[model samples]
Target chain A: MIVIHADMQIKPEKREAFLQTVQPLVAGSQAEEGCLRYTLTQDVANLNRFTMIEVWADQDAVDRHNASSHFTGFFKVSTDFFALPLKAEKFTAADV
Target chain B: MIVIHADMQIKPEKREAFLQTVQPLVAGSQAEEGCLRYTLTQDVANLNRFTMIEVWADQDAVDRHNASSHFTGFFKVSTDFFALPLKAEKFTAADV
Candidate 1:
């Protein structure tokens, strides 16, 4: 499985707007094939910081997700929401 | 559900030892009653960075897991493995 931890720090004034903007993307992504889980969570200690935990079946699934309209649309205007550049970490589940 | 994202930046030399230490804890935690998901993943861009994604059934479950021997044992030795302090972000799954 491919996992993505997209850490976002939103501008304080844009908090509500940011949440509103992501709701559709969250719902849209979750409904896609190979999307095992796609959740937006607020950091308990920092309300302005949010992380989207995304689990996909494979790289191809993630590619499709990236090209999806919902994703593309969000990316186009994403800069306006950021307090800092987003940090996205992609990972392959480690075998233990 | 309660979700935890425990981000760790391990000392380069301690990577192997760190993985070995976490194996038993991972297994033990997965076998616990409330562990929905417990998996360690390595960042694709950083060999020494790892994150454990944990999903629990509830707060009580999290409390139980925290007090488990496997967890405590790992915690006692965790500082030895870190190159930087661990960052743990706890979140309540957001409603969308």
Candidate 2:
């Protein structure tokens, strides 16, 4: 299994709007094939910072996700409100 | 539900040992009653960095997990290998 963490710190003024914009993307991604989980969470200490923690079957699953219309279309529009560029980190289970 | 991301960058020299040290803690955490998921993932781009993405029933569950002897005992041992202090960020599902 592979997991991807996409962290974003949106401008405080646009946080709510950005959240609204991504709601549909979140729901859409979760319904996609190979998506084990796709959840968006707001930081308790810093509400402006949010992360989408996604679990997928493999790289192909992730690639398909990024290419999906929901991500490429709707999610991209929220980029303008970002305080900083999105930071994504990917990981997989260790052999151990 | 509450989710916590406990991120740590471990000393590269002690990576393998640190992973071994935390294996039991990971297994133990998963068995806790309130734990929905507790997974340790190594960043694919930076193996030395790891994050424990945890989903709990609520705050009380997290408190119990932190107080659990297994975590207090085994998990703390691995902290010595950390290059930077553990950075824990907590979050919950947003109203959106």
Candidate 3:
């Protein structure tokens, strides 16, 4: 499995606007093939920070999701709300 | 396997302090038995939000980690820094 954790720091004043714009993007992503799960969550202590956690069947699925039009459109509109650049990390499950 | 995604909102000014307090807890968690992976990440757009992603071999491992003394100590110190209550979600991989 391929897991992606994306952390975004939205400006405090722009958080609600950012979430509204990204909700549709998340909805579209959840409907894609190979998307095991996709979730967006905000931090309790930090009003301006959010996390996007995604689990895919494999790397190919993740790649396809990133390349899809929905992601591109969301990125274009959502980039302006960031307090800092987005940070994404990927992990592959280790064989037992 | 059990996967946990914990989203925390830290007061903007208390973020650094919270991180400092939680670093040791993360290190301790990573060393525990049945811990596949544990990672703490901040959001790119939200400066005050952070996420804790943990993958365990099973539910037992997660339960043990939560009950460990290290986690309890860290929680005591870190709770005061939260801007809101922490929210945690759990997911189990679906059989193919």
Write down the DockQ of candidate 2.
Answer: 0.04
- Backbone-clash count (model 2): 0
Every model: Cα RMSD to truth:
14.4, 15.0, 7.5
* lDDT tens per residue, model 1, A41-93: 66533668777788777788999999999999988877899999998756654
Interface RMSD of structure candidate 3 (Å)? 8.9
Model 3: C-alpha RMSD to truth?
A: 7.5
Compute the lDDT of residue A25 as modeled in candidate 2. Answer: 88
lDDT of 3: 0.79
* lDDT tens digits, residue span B1-96, model 3: 777777789998897798889878888998999998677766544657777887788878988998998899998788789999998767664223
Q: After superposing candidate 1 on the true structure, give the runs of residues whose Cα lies further than 4 Å from its correct spot.
A: A1-96, B94-96
For candidate 2, write residues B12-86 as lDDT tens digits: 999889878887788899999989867676643356877777877777898998899889987658767999989
Model 2 docking tier (incorrect/acceptable/medium/high): incorrect
How far off is residue B16 in model 3, in Å?
1.4
lDDT of 3 by residue, A1-96 (tens): 766767789998887799789977888999999998687766544657676888787878988998998899999888789999998766664223
DockQ-best of 2 and 3: 3
**In candidate 1, residue B13 scores what lDDT?**
98
TM-score of each: 0.54, 0.53, 0.59
